[model samples]
Target chain A: MKTIFIGAGNVAWHLAMLFFKNKNVQITHIWSRNKENAELLKDKLDKNIEIYHSLDSLDFSKTDADLAILSIADGAFESVLSKLILPKNCILAHTSGAQPMEILKLANYNSIKNIGVFYPLQTFSKAKEVDFSSIPFCIEANNKEIEEKLTSLANQFSQKVFQVSSKDRSILHVAAVFVCNFSNYLWTISETILKEKNLPFDMMKPLLEETLQKALEINPSNAQTGPAIRNDEKVIEKHLNMIEEMNLNSNFSRIYKLMTESIQQK
Target chain B: MKTIFIGAGNVAWHLAMLFFKNKNVQITHIWSRNKENAELLKDKLDKNIEIYHSLDSLDFSKTDADLAILSIADGAFESVLSKLILPKNCILAHTSGAQPMEILKLANYNSIKNIGVFYPLQTFSKAKEVDFSSIPFCIEANNKEIEEKLTSLANQFSQKVFQVSSKDRSILHVAAVFVCNFSNYLWTISETILKEKNLPFDMMKPLLEETLQKALEINPSNAQTGPAIRNDEKVIEKHLNMIEEMNLNSNFSRIYKLMTESIQQK
Candidate 1:
């Protein structure tokens, strides 16, 4: 399978590298809004591959690439699609969890017959190496043929792949925000609280690890335990007072109160 | 070493079981306000163990126990201490994370020479079994002899033990609420969101596991990702709107907004 990458961001970099190492998949072309980023990604791949600084300069009709993956930001979908001209037979997919498949069908880009979404449901960072096999891939396509192609490609790298609809994917994205992003913010708050007292953040690591493990093994709601779930008002009031006494952010107290109430509501 | 347990709650149950397995420690006596609970705990341990139904009936001065562990709730500490009497040489300790060591210095209980704290820093559930080796035991005592005895006992069961001060332990407890309790509540929120959409929460297992792994590998402040950190107003607005559309708990949106603001503030 021949593929072209439409962005050189974190998602694109990781996907391109994964595909580049696969003998069956060939990354033929790449482009990004930033020329340096495009070049940086190209340097990581085969030198023989073509790097396009501007999408308008690349002639999609003349290329034989089977797929064009738009791994750009959510806001860039409409603008990127307007300028992107693709071969009628080539499959076009965006690697976004929030956007729908209809977003790929821009007014000028209707000539592109195939449209799909190939979302790798995991957080990506340039500094960290991810194990592609463990990451779940959520595939959504306008039609069966395009879906098969995307699923087959994802199967080559990942062990878990599912055909999720645009609606379900959006819901999954919301939940992902809670588990990944919001929980991470709570972790950041914990780190700050410890820092103020000269306590090493490392002390919380063992508990953090066990919390996740228990949540996964048993359902999170069933596994929940604390002063909040126990409804120990004395401990709750003491913690709230301590947070205020320490001169921490007011948001910390709000979060603590809200989370405690939520846990009790269940 | 001989030990007496003042409460037969989760902490007492787990600790008694652990000490029962160790040859160096022996649980000589057990008591709870509810005699049934004390009997339930006694059944789990050796049949020769003595059970005290009321603190008033037990003659503490006549018992040969060297240590008495007050593993009751924070609210119950004062009432339980008022009725309880201990031998002159017996060390009195509570397995609490929030209360200060000075809390053990009750007016009538001042006759007791030694007081200490043995707080196992982990969330315990009756249904789940925990590995004692990994749990960090925070030990605090009024004097060196009692501190050494508690430290030696904790060392027998756990690989990690620290002499945390009362001020530091209280700070640690607050930090723990964020990382363990608060983070777990966010997980419960995620589960609720997915369930409302008829989506399997199991689908999120991979992402949930990786989020913790990433936070621990890279500092959570630095590991932060998602729309909030990106200041992606488009995605944030869409997620907030979606949360309202789902008719989920209003607290979810409040938590969402507060956490997003907290992340960006840093």
Candidate 2:
């Protein structure tokens, strides 16, 4: 199917590459307000793909395409969808994990018949290309026919595609924030601590890998480890003392003690 | 040279199994206060290795072992070392990361002409066996001769032997607590938050893997990701509210805010 990707951000870039990888789906046009970024990505693509400056500048009303992918930031979907001047029947989809399909409701895009969600539930970095096989795509559409079409398109890139409801996607997204956003923050916390000690972050890498492997092996509940659960007051005290000496972020000691107490609640 | 494993703790069990994997070392005996645990590990061994319940109970002083690896608890080491009567010049090593070699000097064990440390700088759970070949063994010896023998013995089990002074080892241990122990606590905090929000930790695995992989590929200072680091105050507020709802350890708010602030500083 002929397609157009609507952003030059991480997710847009990676998904565009995935679509490009499949000889079946053609990413005909790429758009970003920052034309340079769009052009940079276009340089990596097959010559057949066109590059555009922005959705506002694209003449979607006259363009003939099977589908248009909206991979822009959240809360900006309305503005882009309003700007698209496509026919009422052309498929339109936005890839926001937290936002619902209703966000794309448009009687006419100049009149697009279908609006759907193609939420790929993974964090993507513009600088770092990601593998889609491991990413779960959450699909939702205003209509069944559109959902089926979206699912087929999603399956072209990823191994798994789920027809998820808005509520479920929201749950999934909130969970992603905890797992991805907050978990990355945990690494930030480690980096802060290690830097204070003049220690290399490499020292933490093996342990981090092992922790991920173990958490996957067992139930996260059962997989939990450390002095907090064991209620080892001795080590906890020592750690708090060290935290003080490091003169770290003020919250570290309190967090350590709070977690120690939380886990100690037998 | 014949060798005896004098403890059945995490370190002892793991080291003994690895030593037996080597053809040069003889794991003649596995001694521990918990005889059942020792026997349990011994049964995992292919050969008929001996298991002794106590220091005096083992009559293997007559065995003329070249080295005795005192892998017991720190509190138990001095007494055990004092009791073990090896040949007057037998090499002795302890596996405690924090405890100094001077503890062995005080015991005055007859065979202890040499005192050294063979501290494997990694966390080992009793149930899980570690692949020592990849582990970094940090060694410190009283003299050059002892360092050479310890290096050779350590190399048999591991690819990397860091000739670390006790001072460096102590710093490494402190750094380890920051990574392993502190990181585990973060996992607990994240898990508790997830459980309260009716989410499964399974979803976090991909994010966890990606986060670790990114840190390895990029400098951690540049690898920072999350609301705090991004200065996304709205999401931070939402998370802080979520933490308040779960009563997810007071540390979560402080840690959450502090981490974000630290990243902002960077």
Candidate 3:
């Protein structure tokens, strides 16, 4: 199958690379707002692939493909779609867990027919190597035929694939924010707390990794341990006092109290 | 070296097993208020380890050892320490990250000469198999000789060992709360969000694991992603509205906003 990729960010970079290596897939073109990013992505893969600077000036006929994958940022979807023109029957899919396939349908009101979502539930970094086969791919489309095609395509990249509705995908996105983004922010807090004490952040590495592994081994509720879960008011008070004494953000105390309450309620 | 394990809780169970396996060490006695817990711990390992129901009832003459590790809860530390009777030179230590070595020092003010902290920084579940060799063991003592002996014992079970003061260990404990307890609570919230949507929590495993791996690969601040870091007020607003619409915990929305603002500030 022939595929045209849009965007050159982390998601696009990884997805494009995965598709480029597939024997049955051909990346006809890669487009990004910054020509330099597009060139960088192109330069990382087969140099023969076409590259475009803007979706508005693209010659769809010259780079026409069976599929067009939109891997741009969630906020840029509508604006980017406003400038796009695609050949008839070209399947349109996005890699955003937060966006629905209807956004693509609405954007292409009369010009597009087949639109879908191909959300991969994994965080990507351009500098790291991602084993795509292990990541879960959530695919959805307006109809079964398109969904089946998308599912087959996704299956080529990953062993774990599921058909999730737009509503469910949005819900997943919120959860993803908690597990990935919010938990990560907690790590930053951990680093900050250690930094102030002149303690090595490396000291927490084994504990951090073990905690994550513990969650997978059993229910997180069962795995939970600390002053909050134990409801040790003395330790909790001591921590809060220390936070205040250290002149840290008030949010730390707020989060600590709320989480402790939640764990106690559970 | 010989040791006496006080409290047959999760930490004590794994630790006793480690000591029980070491050719150079002998677990002289295992004490727990609940005889059943002590017996269970004993049954899991060598059958010869003595079991006791209370520190006050423990016959220290028959079970005297070079080291006494109080693995009981922080709340019970003082009460338990008040009941203990040991040989003059027997070193006393605790397996708590929050409690200071001074508690032991104060508890045994007239009788005890050596007090220290031997805190293994990992969440333990009795049912799970824990490989202690990789876990970080933070050791601290009132004197250099006691500190060296405790460090030597800790090194037997773990390669990652550090000599941290009671003050610094307390600081490390607070940071650990953010990384382990608070982060696990975030996982609980993620599970709740998915459960309300009738979605399987297993679907999030890959994303959860990848997020943790990313944090370890680079600084969490640099690894941060999602609408909050991007300062995409639109997506953030949409997520908050969705949380409100679902009638989930108000705390969820509160946490979402606070975390978003915190990430943006950084």
**Model 3: pairs clashing at backbone N, Cα or C within 3 Å:** none
Best by lDDT: 1
Candidate with top DockQ is 1
Best of the candidates, TM-score: 1
Tens digit per residue, CA lDDT, model 1, A1-266:
78999999889999999999999989988988888988998999999888886757546667888889989888777777777887768898989889888988882465688899999999887777789897889999988998998999999999999999998998899899999999988898889999998999998989998888889888888888889887899999999999988787888898899889878887
Query: What are the runs in model 3 whose C-alpha is more than 4 Å off?
Result: A58-62, B46-50, B58-63
Assess the local accuracy of residue A174 in candidate 1 as a C-alpha lDDT between 0 and 100. 85
| lDDT, candidate 3, B1-266, per-residue tens | 78888899888888888888889888878889879999998887777877789667754644558888889888787778777876778888899988888888645556578898889988787877788888889999999999999899888788999998888888999889999899998998888898898998788888888888888788776788888877878789889999989997888888888889988887
| DockQ rank order | 1, 3, 2
Worst 10 residues of 3 chain A by lDDT: A55-64
Q: How do the predictions measure up, each by TM-score?
A: 0.96, 0.82, 0.94
Residue B150, candidate 3: alpha-carbon lDDT: 88
Question: Count of backbone clashes for each model?
Answer: 0, 8, 0
lDDT against the true structure, each candidate:
0.87, 0.70, 0.84
Better of 2 and 3 by DockQ: 3
For the record, the alpha-carbon RMSD of candidate 3 to the native fold, in angstroms, is 2.1
lDDT of 2 by residue, A1-266 (tens): 78888887777888887887788888788878778878888988877778877655656666778888887766466666666666447788888765667867642544777889898887777666567776778899888999999999888777878888886676566556645655555566667776766766666666666656666665345555555665555546666777777786766665556555655663
